[model samples]
Structures are given as C-alpha cells and as structure tokens.
Target: MSDILHVATRKGLVSFKRAGNEWRANAPAFIGQPVSAVLADARDGTLYAALRLGHFGVKLHRSDDAGASWSEIAAPAFPTVETPDDNAPAVDMIWTLVAGGADEPGVLWAGTTPGGLFKSSDCGATWSLNDSLWNLPERKDWAGGGYDLPGIHSVLVDPRDAKSLTVGVSTGGVWPSADGGGSWRLTGTGLRAEYMPPDLVFDLKMQDVHRLSACAAAPDIVWCQHHNGMFRSIDGGETYSEITGVKPSVFGFAVAAHPSDPNTAWFVPAIKDELRIPVDAELVVTQTSDGGKTFASQSDGLPAVSYDLVYRHGLAVDRTGSRLAMGSTTGNLWTSDDSGRRWTQIHGHLPPIAEVAFG
Candidate 1:
C-alpha cells in the first residue's frame, strides 16, 4: 500500500506520495479553480474537496480511487419563498471538510467561510445547512477586524463518541454540540475577546481561535491556538487555560495533537502584532508532552530565523504519530518524522497552500 498526501492549493487538488526519501507530486485531480479544503476518509480512502470559483459559487468533488479522478456534486439549496425578494444570501464558501464515523460509515461535515456549519449524508454528493449553529441568537453580534473574520477553520469529531463535536472560527470563538448539530452553545470561557473592554461582560470580537485538535487517548482533552495565546481544555470545550509562558508571540495559525499520546501536542508561534511576522523571525515547532501544563521548542533541523509564515490550515500529523507535516504561505512543504524534533523540506515550488492533510 502507498501513503498519499492530499493538498489544496491555488491550482487545484494535488496528490503526493513518498518514494524512498523524496516526495513526488501527481497530476492535478480536479483542475478548474482553487480548492479551499481537501480531506481523505480514513475509513474508505474516499477523497473530498471543496472548490471555490469566482462566478460558479461553491462546488464539492469526490473521488473513490484516491485523487486519480473526480466528479462534481450539487450543493444543498437554502429554503426559499415564491416571492423573488425572499432569496437567501449565497453561501460565502466552504473553508473546511471533516469525515465522521470510523466503523459505520456514510457521514461527512463541512464549515463555510461566512461561518456556517453543514452536513451531508450521501457521502459528498449533496449537503444540508445546519441552521442550528448559523441561526443561533448569539451570531447576530459576532464581529471581525483586519483579515480576521467569522470563518470556520477547524472541525474536530470525538473518536470515543461520534455525537460530540467542536468547531472553531476565526473571530467567533469555539462552539460545541453534545448531540451532534441538533443544539449548540458557545464555549469560549477563559478566552479573551480582544475587541472588548477587559471588564465587559461578553465581547463579540474576542478569542479568535484558528486551530483545534482532539487528544486520541483522552477524548475530552483538546489543544487550541488562538490569535493571542495558546490554551488547553481538559473537560472538552467547556473551558481552557493558557499554556505558553515564555512570552512567545502567541500568534499562529496551526496546531496538531499526538496520534497516540493525548498529552503530546504541537504548535507554531509567530509575532502577534499587526505586522504579523515571525518573532525572533524563526520557523519553529513547540511541543507539550504533559498535556498543556508546559511547552518546549523542538527545532533541531528547521529554518533558523527566517520569515516563513505557516498558515492555520497547514499543520497535520499522520495517524501513526511518527511524521509531522506542514506547509507555508511561502510555498514550502516541511516534514519531520522524529516527532517534530528535526525537520526536512519534502516538496516546494507549488502555489500558495490553503490547507493540507495526510491520508
């Protein structure tokens, strides 16, 4: 069996495989416009990708034989009235796609750009709007600034219990659902809303959590990377506490959890100011072995003090927990097989990468 890596770039969905010590890129699977997100089902090896076109709206594609070929599927239509003025606003775009259920298959979920949750039953053929999250009473007050707006960047499904799930947004904080998408609640406690006064009750623009990962051993444990700092939740998404104490920049876009050890996780830190550059201007990966109580830098083979920017959707760990891979906005793909202690540049020269996943 061959190991495949699916990446979403400005060109389209591309596939890569390991050949000895080098990585080789395959032909473009879906070639039309840029793909926002690409995911492979661990259960069946089915590849699903989200394509965003300038005038064609959002399109979902699926491939059964890996990324060798693909077919387009129709998206769910929002409810409408006979009157022309009652038309629903177009879906901004899909930013993330996640597969659920490891045993009894046939479940998929997606999050959109304007920050809406969606579900699909017949694989990736069609979808339905999850209004339970988008229409929540608290959504009316959500706010954004600069390039940070309300868009779902991460969606985590509990391996222990398929019904429980968590979703993270850019400036909208994190939302959790106990019984799937039937009901939802805001679980942004201990997260500082940057736009509000320190003494205010609930600041709508605070806690811009970009990445969230679940612990494999302890399903309730989760690690999150925010615009301001890093946090860990012991009791699922109910609460979180600061983890990084080195006065690090605390402004990064990606985080990943160890496949076997729930307490071990990784995060990339960048400068936190409006300039949005790397602090100390170096590319490094930090790891916490004792859940988020402490953290240490692990950059034996990474770039030393350069201006490479790792996007929020680029960091991922394989199922075996042996290899760690991440892509940068500067068009370089780096991989570390030694649990992030050392690194290597596997593939570069591709267009700007939006998201990456290992299969």
Candidate 2:
C-alpha cells in the first residue's frame, strides 16, 4: 500500500505517491477545470473531488479506484428564491467537501460559497440544503470576507458524535449545532475581529476564521488560523483564546492538527491582514506541541527566499501525523515526511492550489 496526496488546484486535481522518502506527483486530472476541494475516505479508500467550471457552476466526482477513474454525481444546488430576485443565493463554489464520522459510512457534507451547508446520505449522489441555516434570521447578516459572497470554508464533524458539527464561514463567525445541522448558534465568544472598531472586535458574529482543524485525539480541542491572529478552543466551540505569542506574524490561512495528539498542531504564517504572503519573504510551517502555548517555525531544506501564499485548505496532515503536504497559490507543492522538520518540492508551476489532502 502506498501513501498518496491529492491536491486540488485552479486548473485540476493532481495526485502524488510516496516513493522512498519523497512525494512524486503525477499528471493532473479534470484538466482545464478549477478543482477546489479534494477528500478521501479512509474507510473505503474512495476519493471525492469538487470542481468549479468557469461557465457551469460547481460539480462533484467520485473515484472508487483511487484517481484511476471517476463518475459524476448529482451536484449540490440551491432552491429557487421565492422573491423573484436576480441576486438570489446561488452556489458559485464548493469550498469544502468533508466525510462524516467512521460509523456514518455513506454520509458526506459539502460547504458551498454563498454560505450553504448541504448533506448527502448516499455518498455524493444527492444533497439537501440545511434549510434551518438558510432560513435563520442571522443568515441575513452574513457577508463576504473578501469575495463577493460568503462561503463555508471549514466543516468539522465530531469524531465521537456525527450528530454534532461545527462550521466556519468567511465573514460569518463559527457556528455549532448539537443536533446534527438542525439548530445552530454562533460560537465565536472569545474570537476577535480586529478589522472592526476596537469596541466591536469581540462581537460574537464578527470573527473571521480562515481555517479550522480538530485534534484527532480530542475532538473538542480546535486550532484556528484567523484573519488577524491564531486561536484555540479546548471546550470545543464554547469559546476561544487567542494565541498571542506566535512569531513572525499572527495571521495565516491554514492550520493542521496532529491526528492523535490534541496538544500538537501546525500552522503556515503569512503577513498580517491586508498583505497575505509569507513573512520575511520566506515560507515556513510553524508547529506547537504544547497546545497553543508556543510555536516554532520549521523550514529546513525549504525555500528560503519565497513569497508563496497558501489557501485556507492547502495544508493537510496524514493519519499517522508523520507526513505533511502543503500547496501554495503560486502553484508550488511541498511535502515533508519527517513530520515537517524538513521539506521538498514535488510539484510546481501548475495552477493556484485550492486544497490539499493526504490519503
């Protein structure tokens, strides 16, 4: 059996395999289409790819034999607007595609741009809009973080309870639902939005969470990379505490948690808000083994003078916690088999990377 990494980019999907100590990326798939999200279910070794076609909106595909072959599935679609408005909510991108818990086999979730969360019971065959979230009175206040519409960039399903979930939106703060995706409440109590007025920074709905990762050892321990800084939550989604001591810059787009250690996690720091490139013109992945108490930049053997910016889901850790893969908006892909202590570029100059996952 070989360890594989699937990278979704602005142009297509790229697959890589571990050969000896290095990751070797293969030819691109879904050529010419922008692939936004790629996930693989370890339970059955099935791969899922989310694509964004220039003129055709969002699409999804499933591969049972790894990336060898794929079949198109029923894509997620929003219900017609009742107000006859041209600006009605429409899905322009599927920012996240996640599999449910191990016990919940065929269940899957798709987080789409314009802020819609969809669920599918039979893999990616069909979907149902979480009307509860769509009709929520608070949804009217949902705004875009940087794009023209809001998007659900992160989705976390409780490892112990598939019925409980947490979602992170661009401008809309993180929200948690105990009864699956039914009723929800904003859970950004300790998160901050420094972009707003000083007095409004702590508003429950004001935080801008760039990426969220859960510690596999403890589902409640979450690490968040935010627009302004970094944050952590030990009580699940109840509250968060800012990690104020991270070096270089506090702002970043991606965070990855150790698969079996709640206290260990990683982040890729970029320049602060308004400027989103690597700090000091060098790209580094920071790691913390004592929860969020401290962080250290690990960039040995990696590019020293670089200005690459990774997307929110561009960083991912394998189940063993011994491998790391990250791709950048500049179309550079790097991997580390020594738990991020050293890195090597396996692919480059393809297209802007949207997401990366290890399978």
Candidate 3:
C-alpha cells in the first residue's frame, strides 16, 4: 500500500502519493473555498475536510475513497438565537478535526472559531454542539489571536480513551475534558502568556497555544508549541513545564510527537511573533530525539533561504514514525519518509496551506 498525504489549504484540499522513491501531489479539491482543516481517519480510512466559504458559511466535506470524490456534510452550527440579548457566537472557521478512539467507531470531533467544540458520532454526517464547554464563564474572556474571534485550533483526543481529551485555544489557554464533551476545566499554571504584563502573565484563561500534540502510545505525555515557548505535559496536560533551552526559538506554530516514543518529537521554528517568517529567513525543521533538552535542525533538502510561515495545523507525522509532511504559507510542500533526517519538496505554488494529514 502507498503512503498518501493530504494537504488542506486556503484554496482547496490536495493529496500527495508516493511513487517508488519519489512523490507527487494531485490537483486541488474543493476549488475556491478555503479548506481550513482536513482529517484522514485511521480507524476506518475516512476523509473529512472543513471549508470556509465567503458567501454561505462553514462546511464539512467527507470522502470514503480517499480524495477521489467528496460530499458535503452537516457542518457544525450554533443554536438559534433565543432572544435579541442572546450572546450566541457565530462559527467562523473549522480550525481542526480529530478522529475518535478505536472503540468509538464513527466518532469525530471538530474544533472551531469562536471556540466551539462539536462531536459527530456518525462520521461527518451530523454534529452536536458541546454546550458543556461553551457555557463556561471563561469563554467570555477568551480573545482572538490571528482573527477577530478566538478559535480552538488544536484538539488532542487520546486514542486510547475517546472520552478524555485536551484542546488548545488562542487566548483561552488549554482546556482538558475528562468526561468526553460533557465538561471541561481550564489550566495554564505552567504555560505563560508573554503578551501580558508579568503579574498578569499567569492569570487564568490567558494562554496562546499555537499547536498541541500528544503521544499516541502514552496519552499522558503531551507536547505543545506555545506562543511564548515550548512545553511538555507529563500528566495529560494537567500541568506543563516550559523547555526554555530549545535552541533557535521555541516560539513556533507546529509540533509533532512520535507515534510510540513519548520523548521524540518535531517542530517547525519561525522567527518571533513580530517576524512570523523563518528565523534568519532560513527554513528549517528542528527535531529532538531526547525530548526537549536539545534539538537538531534538519535542512537536508529544504530551501536554503525562505520566508514562509507554517500555520499551526500544517505539520503532521504518520503512524510508523517514518513519514513527515508540512506545507507553508508560501505554497511550498515538503515530505520526509525517513524520520525527517532528509526532505523532499513534492509540491509548490498551491494556495496557503492550512493542515496536513497522512493515511
């Protein structure tokens, strides 16, 4: 069987497949619509794509035979406004989609802009709002990072326990739930909010998490690429410890954990928040085989000088711990089949990519 990679972009969704020792990317799907997120579910090999249309609103598309064809599903929608004073938030973007556990078939989770979490028990055919998280008082204080509304960009569900999971928000900090989507509690004791004053940096409901990745083998081990620095949660995000020693810079958008080993992971470094481009305008993928103690920059076949900025969902590592794929805002796509020791640019000149997945 060939290893296939799916890329979600501002323009559409694209698929890349391996051919012998090389790879090739297919034409874009969902043309014209900004595909915010995509998931190639491993449990049943189902494909789900989230799109943002300027005219109609948010949409979710699904494909059973990979990307050969797709059909639209019932996208997550907010409850009808009960009264004129109702504070219902509109859905802006479907930031992330995650498949449920092995025991929970047809279960899928969606994280959206305005910080709404929804779950669909029948693949992507329907969705139900998670009011348990939406009614929290802290939701009102959560502000926007890149857009006018806060978004739940990273939803890390434990493959072992579908009911227990963690989600990353731009200005809302990290929220983990123990009883599926029934209820959630927020935590930021270890992570910092550098954008605020020193005294207010550690205040509740104040965190900017760009990306979050948890080990599949050990769900208790969580790795996060925060807005201020890199962090690892040893107790399933109950608390995080900052890895201040990450060379170059830990302020980045993407983080990928090893499928089995909880110690090894990958990160794509960018300049500080002020300069979102690659550090020194040079593109590199830093990896740490020994946790976050030290990282080695991998630029074997990557661009020499680049200014592309990879979004939070752009980096993905396959199950075997062999294939890695990432797409940047500059429309460049790169993949590595040997644990990221080397790389190959398989596609370029596509739209600003949003997310990457493999199946």
Candidate No. with top lDDT: 2
- lDDT of each prediction vs. the true structure? 0.76, 0.87, 0.86
Where is model 1 more than 4 Å wrong at Cα? 81-87, 145-149, 200-205
On the 0 to 100 scale, the lDDT of residue 200 in model 2 is 76
* Position 154, candidate 1: lDDT: 78
> In candidate 1, what are the lDDT values of residues 1-359, reduced to their tens digit?
22677778877777788888877889876565788888888888888888887788888888888777788876534545466563344566778888876744868888776677888877877778888988887775555522434777778888887788888877777888888889987886877645456674345235678788887767777888877678888889788877657445566888898877988998888887565656787778888888777778877877776676777778888877878888877767788888888898876676777778997
- The Cα RMSD of model 2 versus the native structure comes to 1.4
lDDT of 2 by residue, 232-318 (tens): 999996899889978887888899999899889999988886677888889999999998888888999678888799889989898
lDDT for model 2, please: 0.87
What does the lDDT come to for candidate 3? 0.86
lDDT of 1: 0.76
Error of 1 at 357 (Å): 0.6
35: Cα error in model 1, Å: 1.2
**Model 3 alpha-carbon drift over 4 Å, by segment:** 84-87
How much is 72 displaced in model 1, in angstroms?
0.6
TM-score of each model, paired residue for residue: 0.92, 0.97, 0.96
Instruction: Please provide, for model 3 over 1-359, each residue's C-alpha lDDT reduced to its tens digit, 9 standing for 90 to 100.
Output: 33788888888888888878777777778887899999888889899999899998998889998778888889998887867464656888999899888899999989999999889999978888899898999898888977789999888888777888888898788998888878889875788877798887887588888888988998888898888889988888989889887667787989999888988899998888688898888888889888778889998999888988888888888888888988999989998888889998888787899988887
